[model samples]
Target: MPEVVFPLDSTRSFTDQSLVGHNRWHPDIPAQVHVRPGDSFRVHAREWFDGAIRNDDSADDIRDAPLNSVHVLSGPIAVEGARPGDLLIVDILDVGPIPQEDSGPLAGQGWGYTGIFATQNGGGFLTEQFPDAYKVVWDFSGQVATSRHVPHVSFPGLVHPGLMGTAPSADLLSRWNAREGALIATDPDRVPPLALPPQPDSAILGTLSGSEFDRVAAEAARTAPPRENGGNQDIKNLSKGTRVFYPVFVDGANLSLGDLHFSQGDGEITFCGAIEMGGFIDLHVDLIRGGMDTYGVAENAIFMPGTTDPRFEQWLAFSGTSVTLDGEQRYLDSHLSYQRACLHAIDYLTTFGWTPEQAYMILGAAPIEGRLSGVVDIPNSCATVYLPTSIFDVDIRPSAAGPVRIDPGQGVPRSSF
Candidate 1:
C-alpha cells in the first residue's frame, strides 16, 4: 500500500480538530482517515501542551498553561483490517522534528525546551526536590542539541514519539477508569493528584462535540502515564527500526501518536522531557490476527531496535532504596524510588565538577537508563541509575553520600544520603 499523509489540510495540521486533548482517549472520536493493513504513513504531531510553550518560556508559562491540556495527539487513524484482540504492529520508519519551512510556531530548528514541572501541579518524577517549575531552552543544529541553559553540555538528538496507542474499547475504558479512580481516591492530595477525570471543557481544545463518552474518555485519557493502550511511556529507545505491538481493543484499531520528543533519558527523569519538539513520524502499520491471544500482552509490548546486546559502555551506577536517608518509608513504589535514585545520581554528579542544574540536564539529555534492580524486599524497593560513562569526558566516582529522602510526607531529612 502506498504511504498516506495525514490531516490532509496543511493549515490545520499543527492546530485543529486533528489535535486531541483533555487527557482522555475515546473510541467515539472520528477517525481522521483510514488506511489498509501494510500501509505506511507520515504523521505530524505537535509538542505536548499544544505549543503553549516556547523556547523563551519560563516557569510562569508552565504555571499558566492548563495542566489538563497535555500530550497533544494526532490521530485515530483507523487501520482497515485491525480488530479487537489482535495486535496493531507499528513499525517506526523515521522520526524527526518538523522542518522550519513547514512547521509553524512549534517548529524544531535550533530551538526546543526541556522542563521540570511544578510539584504543586502533580506531575514529574523528582517533584519533591525540584518543587518549582524550571525550563531549559535547547538549540538543535547539525543533528545535535545544545543549550545555554545547560552550558558545556550537548548531545545528538535521538527523536521518538512519547505517546502512541490505539483507542480503547468502551469496556476497557471503563475498567481503566474504575481502577485508576480507586487508586487516586486512596491519596487524593498527592502531588499531581490522582483523580484526573476528563473535564467537560476539554472539548474546547479540539473538535469533539462534547459527547458524554468524549468527556469520560478525555478524563480517562490523561496522557501522563502509560496504560495498556500505550499512552505516555517514555521509553527512549523506541525510535526507528523498533516495532511496537499494541493490543487492539476496538474495531479498526484506531491509532494515535503525539508527545514528540527530540530526546529523553530512559525514565524521562524530568516531568516534562528532553527537547520537546513538534515533528513528523514515518511509520508502517501492520496487524497480527489474534495476536493478543498469541502474545499474552495485556497491554502493549515493544521489540527494541537491536537484539538483547548492550547499547552503551559500562555505566556508572547509583542505587536508591525505598527507605529514605531519614529512615522513613517511601511507600515502596518503584517509580518514586527510581526518581529518588535519579535525584541521588544527580546529587552525586554535583561533586564531579558540575552544578546541580547541569547534572539535571545531563540526566535528561544523555542516554542514561533507570532500572528497577529489585522490588521484592518488603518495605524497600530499590532502583538504579546507570549513566553511560562514555557520554562524559571526565571520570567520576560514586558519591560518599547516599540516597536522600524524597517523600515530603515524611518531612525533609537533615542529612543528605
Candidate 2:
C-alpha cells in the first residue's frame, strides 16, 4: 500500500471535525485517517505531558499537567483490511525527539524531561519513598542521557514508543470499566488498581459522528495500562526493529500511539519515565488473518530482535526475596514481593550519595531492568533488578545502606487519571 504521513502540525484539522489539539485516545474517538494493510506510515506525537514543559522548567511544571491528559497520543489510524479476531503487526522503524524552535540554550534536540508524581496525586511505583514531585531535564547527545539535576550518572539511549494500541469495541470498553471499577472498590485504602478510569473528553465527544456506538464508546474507553486494546505497556524491549502484535477488536483496528521515551528501564518505578519527548514515528503495519487464532491469546505480544544489539551491556544484578533475609514470608502475593525488591534496589543506590529523587530518576532514565526471579515458591518469591554496568564509568554496587524497609501501604490509590 501507500505510505501515510500524520503531520506534526498541531493546527491541522481532521475530517472527523476534531481539531488537531484533540490528541487523546479513546474508543469513542473517531478515526482521523485510514491506511491499507502492508502500508507504511509516519506519525508525529507530543510528549506524554504535552509541550507545556521546558528544559528549565521545575517540578511545578511537571505537576501542572492534568492527570487526565497524561499521554497526548497522535492517531487512531484505521487500518483497512483489518477486522476483529485478526492480528495487527506494527513494525517499529525509527523514533527520535523533536527539535524545539523556541528552546533556550538547554532546550531542543537531544533534550527532554523526566518527572516524579506528586504525593497528593498518589501514583507511581515508588510513591511513598519519593513522595515529593521532582523534575530532571536530560541531554541526549553522544547517544547518552545526562542530567544536571541528577548528576554523577549517565546512560546510553534506547529510544522506544511507550504507548501503542488499538481501539476496543463498545462492549469491550464497558467490560473494562466495570471490571476496573470493581477492583478499585475492593481496595481498603481505595488505591487505584486501574491505570486509567473513564473520564469525559469533550474534544472526543465533539468528533463523534453522532452514532449510538460512538456515544457508548465515549463513556467506557480510557488510555492507561495495557489492555486487550494495547495502551501503555512501557516495555523497554520494544525498540527499533521490534515487532508488536496487537489483537484487533474494532472493524479497522483503530491503532493509536504516543508517550515516547528517549530511554527507559523496566518497572518505570516512577509514574513518569525517561526523557519524555515529542517525536515522529515510522511504522510498517500489516494484518495477519487468523493469526490471533494460532497464537491463542487475545492480547499484545512482542517479538524481540533475534540478536541483542551492541547497545545493550552486561547487567549487574540485585536480588530481593519475598521472605526476609531471615526467611519470613512478608507478602503472599509474588507481585508485591517483587515491588519490595525494586524498592530495596532503590534504597541501596541511595548509599552512593544519591537522593531518593535522584535514584528514582536513575532507575527510570537508565536502562535498568526488572524481572521476577521466581514466583513458584509457595510463601516466598523472589525478584531481581539488573542495571547495565556500562551505564556508569565507576564500579557502582550496593554498599552498606541502612536496613531496607518495605511498606505495603505505600502505593497509588484508585482514582481517575
Candidate 3:
C-alpha cells in the first residue's frame, strides 16, 4: 500500500511552520514519481487567507485587512524510498472534492487554484477585474476569508516545493531573497548538457542573456514597491498534490513557502484579489540522490495529471529578452540559441547516465515548452520557456523507487512570481 501523510494533527497548531497556525505544510515529493492507476494519497491543506473573511464579506474588508499570515500550505511528506540524490517522480493519480458540511464557503465543492501574483491585494491586474480588489487585505483574524470581489472557482491551489532539498543560506540578500525564493531540485538526467554562455555579441536579451536579466531587473525596480516581502511577484506553489524540486544544501531541508493565491488567471497580472481560505492538507515527499540536471534545477518534484492542467516538464528554454531588431536581424541570431538549449538537453541527460534515446524520448514526450507564469508583476517582460509532457514520444515511466521522505516545515515562506 502507498504511504499517506496528513496536516499537523491539531485543529489550531501544526508542526508545519509554513502552515503552522494555519494548518498548511508543504512536503516536497521526488520528481521521478512512479505509480499505478490505483495509487492514492491524502493531503492536508489550509485556506489562502486562513479563515480571514467569509462569503458575505465585502470590499471594505479587503482595504483594511491586515496582509499577513495568509495563504497556508500543507504537507512535506517524504516518499518511502526517496534518497538524497535520486529524482522524485510524482504521479497525479486524480483530483476530487472534499466533502465539508460546515456553514462556510465549501458547501461540498471547494478546491483552490489561482494565477494572481502579489499576496496583498489593493493594486494588481485584478484591480478592475475584481471589484473587491481595492479592499483586499490579509486577515488571519477569523476563519480564512478574502475581500468580496473574486469569483469562486472552487479549485485547490495545488502547490509543489520548487526545489526539494535544503538550499544554501542566502545571507546575501541580493535584490531579492534567493534563499527563501522557493528552491526546486532537478534531475541530472533531465538537464541538457552544459553549453557555453551567450556571447556579449550574441542575440539580444530574450532568454538567458545579460540584456534579458537587466530588463527583468529594471522591470522589477520600475514596478513593485519594496515592502517586507518580495513585492507583487507572488507565485504560490507547493500546495496539495503539488511536487517541487530543490538542491540539497543542508542535510535536512529547511524549506519555507508563501505566495498563496486563491484564484488567478494564467498571467499573474493582477494581485490575486482576495484569494484566501483556511483548512488542512496532506502530501508525500521523497528525496533525490545521484542526479543533477541543468535546467538550473537541482531536483524535480513531479505533480500530476499535474498540479495544474499544464503539468511541469523540464525545458532548455524559459524566457527571452525583448531585444530590439537590427537592420540585418536574423532568426538564427534570435532563435538559434534557444533551439540549441533544447537540443543540448539530450547530451546533458546522457552525462547524468541516460542513453541518447532515453533523453530524446523524454524531451520528445514533454514538449520542451515555455512558461510565462511571472510576466505581469514587477517585470514588464513576459515568457517562461519550458518543456511540457507532450514533447515525448514514449510512454514515460518513473525511474526511482522506495522513496526517502523529507518533511521540513519551517519559516513563513514567500515566493516571487
Q: Which candidate leads the pack in TM-score?
A: 1
The residue-by-residue lDDT of candidate 3 on 285-364, one tens digit each, is 35555443533344233323244443444434434432222323233232333323333454554444444333332322
Clash pairs (backbone) in predicted model 2:
191-413, 191-414, 192-413, 192-414
Better of 1 and 2 by lDDT: 1
**Candidate 1's residue-wise lDDT over 264-311, tens digit each?**
888777767577877788888899999998879766665556232235
lDDT per residue (tens digit) for residues 325-382 in model 2: 4556775566666667776767776665666666677787788878887778767678
The lDDT values for all models are: 0.69, 0.67, 0.31
State in Å the error of residue 349, model 1: 2.1
> Total clashes, candidate 3?
135
Instruction: Compute the lDDT for candidate 2.
Output: 0.67
Superior by lDDT: candidate 2 or candidate 3: 2
The residue-level lDDT of candidate 1 at 172 comes to: 78
Q: Is candidate 1 or candidate 3 better by TM-score?
A: 1
Alpha carbon lDDT at 335, candidate 3: 37
Worst 10 residues of 1 by lDDT: 408-417
State every prediction's TM-score relative to the real structure. Answer: 0.85, 0.84, 0.40
Report residue 411 deviation for candidate 2 (angstroms).
24
Question: Residue 21 CA error for candidate 1 (Å)?
Answer: 8.2
